[model samples]
Target: MMAGLEERLDKMELAIRKQTFRENSGRANEVNFWVFDYDPKKELEVRERIEYMKKKNEKGTEGFQLIVFDLYDMIMEYLEEKDFVNSYGRFEKRRGFDYIIRAVSTSMKMNEDDSILIRKIVEQTPENAVVFLTGVGKCYPLLRSHKILNNLHQSVLKASVVLFFPGTYTEQELILFNEIKDDNYYRAFKLVK
Candidate 1:
């Protein structure tokens, strides 16, 4: 576990619990998006802590609702359900990396209207709930972090979106796995230090 993991989690919880956070007060017109950046090596620990947080704060009642969006799982299930797995691999080898990336991005509906993942995020989230977005590392080369943020900032405006980013968020750009530059997404604030 990382040092002060408990404190960071507590800060996240308290931020999500506060009315101002949900309402986006004093944000200077920024959406209610936050980045909970952590070391990529501690992914399992972060996931465990997230589960603990969810257990402590149940969704839909009593406390604020918490909806987690695991991008890797979402894409896997989607690929399986659509029977695109076989063809997807074939496309990668035949069409080249860039072409395959575009195909997968188009199929995933990234930053587009009627995107299944975006729709799920909007539909599943109730007002004032917390949306935890994980699996950035796993969804690499397909679903970029900035693209999702761009998509959500316009649609899912009510709920507080907390992205469990497995990298560094410098309030300027996202560095996935500390090597890949995920482009600039300055809309979201850093959830904890």
Candidate 2:
């Protein structure tokens, strides 16, 4: 009964379109954060639907904005903009994978209030825009989904934030790709059942 991914996505789409999902609606006390978790193997299909929904909603025919920020792309762009792209690869090769992990973590300011990822998202968010955070699986060993959620808790993201997790959010912790179990608990609710 309405168990297909497409059907679930359609339900989520309808939910976001509701006026109650925006500011001045109900749930003002909550963070308006949500997780749309799915099977890791179906990342491609989910992404396709997300892109399709994004194009459809971003047109503002619904009187609200749907903004998607692929975290992996953000990290790449952040590194590039800061001129770290050149040394990032060489540093990994010379210093090693473990060392590169720390470097990237520090560079991204993981879980910090002033993190580059958080700042970029906060800056680009317009009034009545629903933020969709994606690419969690791709940012592995670099960006943690829980850390991003935790950091967003401290940031000024007033709009609804939905994380398109390529994993399972067990309502308590995030299991990245459904293999790596993350103990970092976040307060975001599931966008749809």
Top lDDT prediction, candidate number: 2
Error of 2 at 38 (Å): 0.6
Q: Estimate each model's TM-score.
A: 0.89, 0.93
Write down the lDDT of every candidate, Cα atoms only: 0.81, 0.85
Where does the lowest 10-residue lDDT sum fall in candidate 1?
Answer: 56-65
Q: What does candidate 2's lDDT look like per residue over 14-63, in tens digits?
A: 98888888763335486688899988888999999889988888577988
C-alpha lDDT of candidate 1 relative to the true structure: 0.81
Give the alpha carbon lDDT tens digit for every residue of 37-144 in model 1.
Answer: 888998998999888777877644536677788988998998899899898788878888798778778887776865878888888877767789999889887888
Model 2, residue 93: C-alpha shift (Å):
1.7
Give the residue spans of candidate 2 off by over 4 A.
24-28
- Please identify model 1 stretches exceeding 4 Å from their true place: 1-3, 59-62
RMSD of 1: 2.5
